[model samples]
Target: MTRSQTTLAADAELTGVAFFTGGDVRVRFRPAPAGTGVLFVRTDLPGEPSVPATIEYALELHRRTGVRRGEAEVQLTEHVLAALAGLRIDNCRVEIDGPELPGLDGSALGFAEALRSTGVRELDAPRKTLRVHRWVRAADGDAEIVARPAEGHGPAAAGLRLEYHLDCGPERPVPPQNFRCEITPERFLEEIAPARTFITADEIPALRAAGYGERVDAADLLVFEPDGTVRGNAPRFPNEPARHKLLDMIGDLALLGCDLHAAVASRKGGHALNRDLCRTLRAAATRGDAPITEAIGVSTDPAAA
Candidate 1:
């Protein structure tokens, strides 16, 4: 009875979620009074069109994740939606102007704070949930995504276990990092969520030249030089880098719009594998497949996706 699992938003609070750093852009999660689920709106536009959290609206670009409805679009929605969905928030509108979301602290912490502070309220109505009914798996070079149901998991989870293998150089301050965790809000915050976004010195020049994460500075994200943090960082949690990878996975997976419930195991999993897993999983669930518990896959010290 084990198959792949598939798993957000609308007025359903005007303030359940909100905007980022750019004063020009406004990003907020508004509740759909009709319980239409959460919808992300871009108020900067004249009409302030909406982008519902669904596969149809998601744009399938490998560079950076984005969502769209007709011509309107929102990019890098993983962080905010991940925090919202992880915190068990199911309804709100996430509105923004610009295409890319601010990299922010590079962690889900900021988004998590907003969702928790505003909070989720249960309606007299029962929430809609997607149950895992099949088995599904997708993979790319050195990356793979698998979804299965929880053994006895509750509604709050779409089981997840993410792994990362970092190969460092002689000059690299970081070592070969690896981490694993059963994805959950508590586990997310404690083990996976706090891990900050990071990039090696080798990539700094390209990032700056490409104008990536412009809203953030070295202090905001963990920019490890050949030595280490330029000045310093919150403190390396040994597995912090791997944990951060998990954080990205959580955020990206949230885009699937279902509470992921499975013994999900990912390796080298970035947005590509993460999003593909969600798509594959959603397809399986939509077709009515049962969820699985223990899955058969390589458990790398730092798993790949």
Candidate 2:
């Protein structure tokens, strides 16, 4: 059966420290009307400037995703976007009191839990989905992504599926890791949401030198040593780094402003490459270049069920 659009049932709030700024931030998720799309409002700004959470507004990939509108910008938006998309939330008003989102536990779990507690309310409108009818690929050096037609099964019939692979190299510590799964709200929370973002022990100095991560401690995130041992925190999943990559990918894709129906295979790809793919897909859809398939593995007729 086709799914209806969704938003939060009630307003929810979260507060923590910004990873880069070390400043306190308060974020609120308010339920938006049908078709409103995800939005970020800077409540701290003079005019309370708002920006749509779309790839078109995505700026430079300086370690994270930043969405901008004129002079207003929001940094590190991927985690919150991932939670909204993972839960199949279609519309939301994300109000933040700072330039960047709080880096709560270095994972999307905090946002997910808050949103879950508020509950999801289905809208009257049927969800809009973008189907991939042709193979499309984008790359940046060795990192790459290939999107193909989905094999409509379970969640893939309504949304998308992802197969992600991450290789951190031999010298850096963490070994090669990969994961493949059909994307869904249930699967995301259990398999991907809990996976925290990670950094190598060696990268600490450079990160500090660059003026970032001042508020986050080694224990607050997954930190691996050159000897392949975790520094302070434990991993939520065996291949937690790879799963976090998948989480980031989902957040980046949410900028498409609709549910996606494709099988995306990614290898060592980061924010820049994912942004490029999103732009390419939007262009192809605009030009009517890629063919459209209504459903893949399941019957499209709601009555068929």
For candidate 2, write residues 1-305 as lDDT tens digits.
Answer: 45688999999998999999889999999999887788899999999998888877899866789899865799999999999999988899999999999989988999999999999998998776678878889998888998888776665355588978999776779889998878778998899999888999888999999888887898678999888889887788899999999999999998877778888999999888889888887777656564643332222222221
lDDT of 2 at 139: 90
Task: Estimate the TM-score for candidate 1.
Answer: 0.77
Among these predictions, the greatest TM-score belongs to 2
lDDT measured at residue 74 in model 1 versus the true structure, 0 to 100 = 81
**Candidate 2 vs. true structure, TM-score:** 0.93
| Per-candidate local distance difference test | 0.59, 0.85
TM-score of each: 0.77, 0.93
lDDT of 1 by residue, 139-210 (tens): 876666665544565544434544555545456776666776666567766666667777777876676576
Give lDDT: candidate 2, residue 116.
Answer: 94
Q: Mark the regions of model 1 whose C-alpha exceeds 4 Å error after superposition.
A: 1-24, 131-135, 152-173, 227-231, 234-236, 289-305
